[model samples]
Target: MPRFAANLSMMFNEVPFLDRFASARAAGFEGVEFLFPYEFPADELRKRLNGEGLTQALFNLPPGDWAKGERGMASLPGRQQEFRDSVKKALDYAATLNCRLLHCMAGLVPAEVSLTTATSVYAANLAWAAEQAVPAGVKLVIEPINHRDMPGYFLNTQAQGADIIAAIGSDRIGLQFDVYHVQVTEGDITKRMERYMPVIAHMQIADVPARNEPGTGEIGWSYVFHRMDELNYQGWVGCEYRPAGDTVAGLSWRERFAR
Candidate 1:
């Protein structure tokens, strides 16, 4: 069976960040993940986790100036220094939290930069990022975000993500397979999961067409869940979605899976 983690950034928006920890635990989540943790000190977040007896499953490296519309800096050329700085920062937090996985988002492909340049930079960045992550015992992950959801995103397909991981040639570098994004971009969820299971370190979920809790849209959640079990996906499956109603009330889907 797969372990489920509450995505504090998306699902538990009804409360303050600190309070979301307890809310997740109350809702029966054994682990949790969030978009970014730079706002509060790591110690404070740790206090909440220890209090709730929950584990920090995963989190992202800072996307450069998110408010300024930067998605991530990994693939952005001339930002190599900044990307390295971000990796060090991520390692610090991951070490402090004992979190073993970190998602590295590939930033938007700027119009002026050639795809060739961005590709080289992205591959080099991941190779370098892996050196730091491996020693820290943390795996660096790259997620294949869909173009429709993130219009200018550089990494947009499972094949592309797998290729990058293969090129980087490091066990420390892996894929953050978001089921919602993969279904939107590729449509072959089960096969892709099985095909990339060796390179996938973490996973996320949301129903298609709505990006809401499972079962709210077209995805056959039961099959997805059962398939992961059949494949023995021993990784965290993050609940990364918006709720259609009260957060707690939308948990029937999770309850059904927990059985």
Candidate 2:
């Protein structure tokens, strides 16, 4: 079976953010990931993780003033300084939290910038991030979020993500391949997983059509787990989905896959 991490941001909304570490551990998760840790002080989050004996599996870098609808600024032309500053801040938190992977969101494209400019800026930003992350013992990752969940998201497909990785051409950065997003954008889930396994740094899970627990949708998670083993994917598979009902009650899929 694949090693699983509870996405505390989405998985344990029943409790406060800091308290979700204990909730996740109580529910048998060995690791945890979340959207952002910038709001919480690094020491405080580290204390909770130490108390629960959980590993910080993953988290995204600051996505530029999220409340204002700015998802990220990486691909934006003039915000390069802000983007680099976020990477440094994230590295500080990752060092304290012992998280090796940090995702950098490519915010939606601006109407003023051409696609070529955005792509060039994206690659340059990623190259700078890789330069920083390589020395910090962290991996910088980018994910292709399905456009349905995030319309106008700059990066919206594995092909696009792979291209970015290729352009950067560094080991310190990789793709955060969310199965649900791939399924939503492209149906060849397992084949794509295998095809891009080399550049895949971290993976996330959510069933398609509903973006809920596995059995609630059509994904054959059993086969996915078995295939992951066959392909030797040695990274955490994050449970980044909303629970259909209660958080813990909808964990029958975990029970089924927890070998």
Candidate 3:
């Protein structure tokens, strides 16, 4: 069976961030993930997880100045120091929370920066980050966000992420395969999943067209879940979608497909 994790960042908007832990537990989720935990102390987040008996599935490294539209600094030149500091801070939280996986976002590439330069910087930064993560017992992950959702986002395909993993050494870093992004950027989801399953450390899901719960969109969830089982993907499939209605009500898709 494929395990599901509630993405507290998107789901459960009915309550405060801290309170969503209980909401997730009440909703029958055994694991949880979020975009960022920097707003609260690591210990406080850990306490919530412990109180709810939920596993901390994953979170992202600090994105630079999200308010100013800075998604992440990994591919941006002259931001190596900031990126390194972000890595150190993330590892600290990972240690405190006993979480094993952290997603590294590849920020938007400026028009002035050529793809070759950005790719080179991204690879080099990931290499350094992976070296640091190894001793901490934390495996880093990189996600390929769709350009439609995050325009100019440096990473945009499973093949690209897998190549980076191969070059950086898969032991240190892996891929965060997000279903919605894959469907939007490129179809043939199952084939991509099968091709990259070996390097996929974590997975997330949302329906295409509207990014809602699975059954609300065009995806054949039954087959997707079944294919996951066939592929022997033993990782959390994060419910990272916006609820069209009540969050709890929309989760009925889980029973319908994940069984």
- lDDT by residue for model 2 (10-75), tens: 988898999999999999999999999888899999999999999999999999989989999899
User: Against the hidden reference, what TM-scores do the models get?
Assistant: 0.98, 0.97, 0.99
Per-residue lDDT tens digits for candidate 3, residues 37-141, read 999999999999999999999999999999999999999998999999999999999999999999999999999999999999999999999999999999999
RMSD of 1: 1.0
Which has the better TM-score: candidate 2, or candidate 3?
Answer: 3
The superposed Cα distance between candidate 3 and the true structure at residue 12, in angstroms, equals 0.6
Which has the greatest lDDT?
3
List candidate 3 stretches off by more than 4 Å: none
| Top TM-score model | 3
Native-referenced Cα lDDT, model 1: 0.92
1-259 in candidate 1: lDDT tens per residue?
6799999998778998899999999999999999999999998988999999999999999899999899999999999999999999988999888899999999999999999999999989988999999988999999999989899899999899999888876486888899999999989899999999999889999999889999899988888999999988899999999999999999999667645
Candidate ranking (TM-score, best to worst): 3, 1, 2
Q: Clashing pairs in model 3?
A: none
Q: Give the Cα lDDT of each candidate.
A: 0.92, 0.91, 0.94
